[model samples]
Target: MRLALAQLEIESAAVEDNRERAEAAVAEAADRGADLVALPEIFNVGYFAFDAYQRAAEPVEGPTLSRIADAAREHGIGVLAGSIVEDLAETESVETPADEGLANTSVLFDRDGRRLAVYRKHHLFGYESAEARMLVPGESLGVAEFEGATVGMTTCYDLRFPELYRDIAAEGADLILVPSAWPYPRVEHWQLLPRARAVENQLFVAAINGSGEFDDAELLGRSTVYDPWGTTLAGTGDDPDLVVTDVDLDRVAAVREEFPAWRDRRL
Candidate 1:
């Protein structure tokens, strides 16, 4: 499949403008013949725009995602609609006792504008951030099928947890999409973890991150795609980019069979 990494340059609290930017990027990706387009995390309100979280939070079926779903249908391409600060109450399915707080949620839209899966971020960052205190941690894992690949979704901080990836892998996922808002000074970690997960699991990994600076932090926009062999297929610098590349879904099984790493795993 040909994938487009929409490394958006998110603006702080500029919801309407950022939505427009993402729409245009989706169009560009379609024009470039990408079968699927994955966006950066929190591209709508900017990840570090902590104050805007409460105000910008919307329901799962809110206008922001509706617009993106329309774009995906119009372009006849599947889309990983980055992520949004979601008011869980808006989507009754996600509501829980912690519905009093918000959830960092990601949605997947098929080419026909169908909502396939919704994944709230499982790991909330606690290192000098309000996420842990403000948002409810997600409790479930989500996986779907797209273009002959079993796809799964995860957010930025979740990449640091191998058990989560292993769970998805055990469920027969071949390609995992990570929407991120990774910041500067941790570029090495950003580069290392995704490739490590891909090589160890023998599955394709696509990590899409945002660009631009917020009041409290700056994003490192190295959106990347790694093959099952841990080879870097496509990557961007620290800037807004549409990193597009093709990946063979068949390679996942080939690599797993040839490497035998999965066969060596022990409890």
Candidate 2:
């Protein structure tokens, strides 16, 4: 499968501009022959825009994801609408983690514009940030079958927890997509975690981050895709880019059979 990771240039509280760029990227990715394209976390309302979270919040099937689904159908490519600030109170289509608060949520759309999965961020960032206190945590894992492969979804801070990836791997997931809004000074952690998860889980892990700066933070955009063997198939520097690469779905099973590391897990 050909996957595209769009490292978008996000502006704090600039909902219209951000959504426009994201849709353009989707069209470009599809034109580039990508079967699926994934966006970064909170691509509409920048991650560091804490004050704007409540104002920019929308339901799971709000305008943001609705436009994304339309773009996917128009381009005839699957899309992971990276994530949006979800107004759980207004969200009635899906089971929300909370009823009165906001949550970091992502939605996946098929080529035909059908909703496939909804993944609220399980691990909310708490270190020097307002994320944990501002949003409700997701209770369920997001996994779905798409294009002959089982795909799993996780958000930025979730990369620090390997147990989540292990659980998804145990669910027979072939590829994991991480929609992140990682910032500077943690570049090493951003680089290390995804590769480790891919190698250990024997599956593809694509870490998609955003670009541009906020008032108190700057998103370090080194979007990347790692194969089952922990090899970097395609990656970009800390800038706005669309990283695309072909991944063999069969490689997941083949590598697991050859390495047998995952099979040896006793605990």
Candidate 3:
């Protein structure tokens, strides 16, 4: 499968402009024959733009996702519409009544614009940030099939937790998509974690991060794709870029069979 990672430059609270840029990136990726296109975390509203979270938050079927679905159908390619600030109160899908909370959510759409899976971030960041206090944590893992690959979804802070990736892999995921808004001063950790996940889980990991500054933080936009063997297939620098690369889904099986480490695991 050919995957496109869009490292978009996000501006704080500029929802419309960000959506337009994301759509254009999807179109460009599709034109280049990308089977799937993924965007960075909170591409519409900057992650550190905490003040805009409530105002920009919307339901699962809000205009943000609708526009992304249109792009997916228009290009005939699957899309991972990164993470969004979801207003739980505005949504009709969930049963419980959390009348005053929001969740950080990621959505997946098929080539024909069919909704595949939705992943709300389980691990909310709190390192000098207010995500934990502002958003309600998600309760489940996300996995789905697309173009002969079992894809999984996780957000930025989720990368720090290997058990989460293992759980998703247990649910039959071979390709993991991570939408992140990771900031600077920790680029080392950013680079190390994804590769570690790919190698340990024996699955492909594609990490898509954003570029640009927010308040007092700046994103380290080194979006990367790793094969099962922890080999870097494609990566971008600390800039806004569209990194496209081909991946062999069958390699996952091949690597597992050749290494056989997963079978040796014990309690």
Candidate 4:
């Protein structure tokens, strides 16, 4: 499968501008022959924009995801609508983690614009941030069958937890998409975690981060895709970019068979 990771230029609290850029990226990726395109976390509202979280929060089927679903259908390519600040109370279409609160959420759409999965971020960042206090944690894992592969979704801070990836791997996931808003100074961690998850889980791990700056933080772009063998197939520096790469779905099984480390897990 051909995958495109969109490292978008996100501006704090600029909902309309961010959404436009995300849609444009999807169109460009489709034109570039991508079968699927994944976006960064909170592409609609910048992740560091804590004050705007409440105002920008929308339901799973709201305007942001609705436009993304339309773009997927128009382009005839699958899309992982990176993520948004979801207003759980207003969302009646899906089962929310909380009845009346905000959550970090992502939605997946097929080429026909069908809602395939909704993944609220399981892990909320707490270190020097307001995300944990402002959002409700996701209670379920997001996995779906798309094209010829099983895809899983996770957010930024979730990369630090390998157990989540292992659980998804147990669910027969072949590829995992990480929608992140990772910042500067921790470039090494951003680089290490996703590759490790790919190697240990014997699956593709694509870490998609955004670009641009906020008042207190600046997004460190560096969106990357790793094969089952932990090889960097495609990547970019700290800038808005479209990182596309072809991945063989069969590689997951081949790597697992060769290493057999996943099967030996006693814990």
Candidate 5:
């Protein structure tokens, strides 16, 4: 399937401007005849824009996701919407809760406007700041069939965890999609981690990240796609641009057949 990765710049807390940018990028991806279009993590509201979550967070059926579904249906292309703040009303409190705070959520939609799955970020980054304090970590990773391939879904922080990828791989996922808002200094990790996961798991990895600086942290937008052989098929350099690549799903089968590393694993 032909995937268009929108590696674009996002201004922290500016939802309107970011939405315009994302819309344009999706349109551009459609123009290129891409079967699936993916965006970076929290492109609507910048990742460092922590304060915006309360205001920017909306339900999965709300504007942000609704717009994406419409776009996917309109253009006849599947969409891998990057992370957004999802308000969970299902788990609301009586005293102070209209809804439980925020979840770093990635929503996928098929060309027919069907909600494929919702994968919230299971690993919330709390090593530095207090992401766990505000954001609710997702319960599980999600896999869905889209664009003729079984795609495993993960968010930014989840990329650092190899077990998550391995679990998905064991579930027969051929391609992995990671929507991230990785910051600078860790730029190398953002680039290297995904490739390493691809190599180890023997699956195609498609990582999408946001560009531009936000607050005190700058997002190093080096969105990348790696083949099953760990080849860098496409990569960007901390800039706002789209990386388009055609990924042949059959390669996953071919590589696993030749190497047979996954099958030989004892543990």
Candidate 6:
């Protein structure tokens, strides 16, 4: 299938503007005959716009994901709407309507606008401060079959966990998708980790990251795609551009057939 990754800038809690841009990018991808489009994580609110989470968080059925769903249906293309500040359903005890289940959630919409899956970030990044304190960690790993490939879902910090990818692969995922807001000073890790995962797991790894500078941090935008043989099929630097590429599922079979490493694994 032909896949396009939209790596762009977020407007720091500006939902409408980011939605418009995301719509435009989806349209562009559709015009190019893409089967699926993957967007950057938290494009509505900048990654470092931590202060705006409370004000900008929306429910799963809210306008943010609904907009992407509408766009996906309109274009007759699949969409991997990046992470959004999710406002969960109202609880019994909490009086404040504002205090909903706030999670960093990623939603996938099929060509018909039906939601395929909603994967929240299982691993929260709290290295410097406390992302876990603010957001709720996900309970389940996401997996789905789309465009003839088994797709696995993950967020920014989940890249550090190899077990997640291994579990996805064991569950029959040939391509693992990571929607991230990974920052700089550790750009080397960003580059190395995904490729290493691809090499080690013998599967395709696709990372879609944000570009441009946030409030106090700058995301290293190197949205990329790797083949099953651990070769760079397509990649971009720290710039906001759509990285589009076509990957055949047959390649995975061919590589595994030739190497036969997975069959010999004792673990």
Q: What's the TM-score of every candidate structure?
A: 0.97, 0.99, 0.97, 0.99, 0.95, 0.94
Q: Per-residue lDDT for 1-267 in model 1, tens only?
A: 999999988999999999999999999999999999998888899888889999999988888998999999998989999799998777765444364679888889899989888888999999978889889988888799886789989999999999999999999998999999999889899999999999888999999999989887899999999999889999989988899999899998888888899989996
Clashes per model (N, Cα, C within 3 A): 0, 0, 0, 0, 0, 0
Q: Which stretches of candidate 3 lie over 4 Å from their true place?
A: 94-100
Error of 4 at 47 (Å): 0.2
Question: Where does model 1 exceed 4 Å of error?
Answer: 93-98
Select the stronger candidate by TM-score from 4 and 6: 4
lDDT (10s digit) by residue, model 2, range 18-114: 9999999999999999999999999999999999999899998799999999999999999999899999999988987776899999999999989
Worst 10 residues of 1 by lDDT: 91-100
Model 2: residue 118 alpha-carbon error in angstroms: 0.3
lDDT digits (tens) for residues 83-124 of candidate 5: 788888632321222246678888888997788888888889
Q: In candidate 6, what are the lDDT values of residues 33-88, reduced to their tens digit?
A: 99999988888887778888888888777888889999999999999987888876
Candidate 4 C-alpha lDDT tens digits along 1-267? 999999999999999999999999999999999999999999999999999999999998899999999999999999999899999999998988778999999998999989999999998899999999999999899999998789999999999999999999999999999999999989999999999999989899999999999998989999999999899999999989999999899988888889999888898
Candidate 6 accuracy as TM-score: 0.94
Q: Give the TM-score of candidate 5.
A: 0.95
**2 or 3, greater by TM-score:** 2
Give the RMSD in angstroms, all C-alphas superposed, for model 1.
1.2
Looking at candidate 6, what is the lDDT of residue 139?
A: 73
Task: List clashing residue pairs in candidate 4.
Answer: none
Off by over 4 Å in 5: 90-99
